[model samples]
Target: MIESAYIHIPFCSHICNYCDFAKVLYQKKWIFNYLDALKKEIQLNYQNELLKTIYIGGGTPTALDLEEFKYLLEIISTLNKQKEYEYTIECNVESLTEEKVKSMKQYGVNRISIGVETFHKHHLKIMNRHHTKEQVVEAILLLKKYGFQNINIDFIYALPNETIEEVVSDLCNFLKLDIPHISTYSLMIEPNTPFYLNHIKTIEEELDFSMYEKICRTLKKNGYEHYEISNFAQPGYESKHNLAYWNNAFYYGFGLGASGYIPEIRYTNTRNLTKYCNGEFCFNQEKIDFKTKMENEMILGLRKLEGVNLIQFKQKYGKEMDSIFPIRQLQKEGKLQVHNRYLRIPEEQLYLSNEILMQFIDT
Candidate 1:
């Protein structure tokens, strides 16, 4: 009953300083071989289920040349797609050409998430991202010209030395676009990324918190629902594929470094390209137990603004929330509350949700 799949293309024309995803410079030889491996992996694992959503993420999936992008699409065409499926691809404005956009349309791509980290040229250079503001404008205009309206633009705030004014400026530009979806993330200098290697530090906590509050307030005022902690969407445009993950549903993850979840198992593909291409797709997997599943159910479900459904949880897991976890304690602490039958974190306390969620870890 897996209804979603995430395909990864670990090839980028230029590596951004903050990115640590499994990726390498776009090499023609590697691209062809990787496509072969990806196709084989899908053929072997896909059970012909009519997937409701398929997300093609990167290393910039649109970085491929015109012919290579077409071949990749052709490979994806073999999947059993639902009548009204959501097929999304991650793209960078510089490489997402007109031909690629048309090819995506022909292959049933209904959504395109662009990597416009920030609108400021100085911030772009600071993050080692090459696309200019004008390029992003052209890219969006082009996508709209092709009748693709379900678009999302990613933004990263809390950069080293980043100010609230800069973040406000970026949001101002984003609001003008009138796009349906937006995903914003705070800067975390994870180990192994160029930012980490160069000793980049995050912004002050107060500023970071302020930036988050600003983003939430602005997007909500502009008629976007704060569906998730980092995602805002206009009613019907929330990413179905991502919602699958937060809902604790199963999905297939294909390609090097991709992760997937089945009925009781979660697996991640190997990051080593050589091993991945040689048919060693998954390197780590864990069989999930009932206790683990329940914990995951709470942790993942609580991420949504609406939180988890009480009766649905009992029906699915055969246990009430109070019987399985300390719901009353969280409720007493004012961290979680029930609203219209849904147990959710209060809007003001969402920023501290991680601390509250940790209490249910092993209960």
Candidate 2:
């Protein structure tokens, strides 16, 4: 059963240079129509089953004005919530005010993830991010004041001209916030983004590795565990919604440009706003076969630091992981190791995980 749902709000107040998510500028009239369509889509897709987690992400979910946010929250509140429900909403530091934070609290939101890509002014300007460092601090303080302790802050490193010192500075500032969760990312220049349009090149691989190492070292020195490749969290605070994806569990994805996996089918909604507002929800879908499903399970499972549970994997797929894949060969190559019945990438070899995971592909 799908115990989680992800809702997308495809509107941003300002377009960032590096963002390629399906989003448009926020307009009141468009938002109204979009919400109307979103309600229809949810009503049709949701089975009124109890959901354990609900995540609202987007260009910036908090970019919606107060009234629009309330309406969206009201619609979401109708979902059958579980006793251990974890409802999260993404917020941009610039647009998330005290009132907005309070409104989320009033609507049963227990978690908030803020996009504070970097604390450095130069990097912020290059990325076209408008949130000031002061705003981020104030937002966190406000969330804390209102009893919202389950907070997450995002940081990006290895920008166009970022240096080791700069990345460390960003990490230091991030640590100072005392937030429970931190998600760090090394910059990737994806196609169709402003950075790609401007012909931006990625930083050197060595530098990127250095930044990743620093993040791992610093966060580990503190109380945070590197649970996922890009996520660090204090114990008991890992993102349940995100883990549902990494575990290859089923979930419902609603609103424009969202994707979901339901049993054998994986689907993505249309990115075209006009078509989505007209009630055409899905743009692409694939009926997954057994082999494909196992491949997804391996790829997604390896993302977690604890790796795939061998017994659980056998129970779910009814096949031994060693029989289906060359696990013994990978162990000899020093890329992967099975420890305590969990097949995981060695801590020192994590940076090269992509190369190691490729060997498991049946093709």
Candidate 3:
């Protein structure tokens, strides 16, 4: 069952030097045409069932003008569901406005994810991000004023030239907010990004790993649950929309560069904006075999802090997690711990989880 929907809006006001997400510079005419095509696509795939969640992420959804934003929201409001579902909209800090937030609230959006990557102006400029810290504060306050209660602030840590003190200071800035959710990630120098081209020196491996642990401890001390690899939420405020993805549930993905998984197939659309905009859709689809599915179950399930449920895996796939897996091996090596029915990597091994999880795959 397609219980979740992920819609991509591939336009941004300006490409941040560090961003690698599929996006093109904002053009008024391009947006109008692209939006029309997007709506047409949505109508064609519109399922008249109550979805469990809907996530509207983008290069920067807030970059659109009030009218364009409204047009997009009005189109998505057509979702027919049995109950109120989680509807999340990602917004850029500088572009968010009170009116835009109000439009989202009226259109049934229950959560607003603001990209406040960091709280330092110098770090912002260094990253080539255009938003000011004060602007993020304004956007957050605006969302609250518009009667939205569930707000999630996205933070990035461990950037080049970042020190432990600086990271903790950034956390302090985020802590001042009343928001219930925050997602943090170590800034990596992705292969094709400008940061990589400029040879931006990332933090030391050990230091970066230490920072990750510190964040978990601090956030937990501040009364948040470290639920997933990159997510922390106050009790009962975890992102349900992302949870569906983490759970490997079927989701409908729309717009160019988006990916969808239904039944045995997983596919991603073309990344070429021109080709996608020209109505020539490209999909890299693959049928997942049993071996692949089991591998995914092991790797993705381990991403959750609570790890995989042995009984649940057996019920879903008709095999014990430890039977065809090396659970005892990982435990013997001290990389993983088996508690009750869940097998999870130790908190200290989280940064090296990719290395640990790879052991479950068939080489």
Q: Write the per-residue lDDT of candidate 2 for residues 246-274, one digit (tens) a residue.
A: 99999999988999998779999999999
**TM-scores of the models, in the given order?**
0.99, 0.99, 0.96
lDDT of 1 by residue, 220-278 (tens): 99999999989999999999999999999999999999999987899999999999989
- Tens-digit lDDT track for model 3 on 1-363? 788888888889877767888787888887777777677777777676578899889888878999998988877777664485889999997788778877887788989898888878788888888888788878888888888879898888888888888889988888898789999978877878888898888888889888898899889999999989889999989999888877777887888788887788888878887777777654688999988888888888888888887888899899877788888878998989977888888877787889998898983
lDDT of each: 0.93, 0.92, 0.83
Q: Which lDDT value does model 2 have at 267? A: 97
Q: What lDDT is reached at residue 165 by model 2?
A: 97
True-structure RMSD for candidate 1: 0.8
Minimal lDDT window, size 10, model 3: 75-84
Q: Give the local distance difference test score of model 2.
A: 0.92
For residue 210, model 2's alpha carbon misses the true position, in angstroms, by 0.7
lDDT of 3 at 85: 82
Q: Rank the candidates by lDDT, best first.
A: 1, 2, 3
Residue 43 displacement in candidate 1 (angstroms)? 0.8
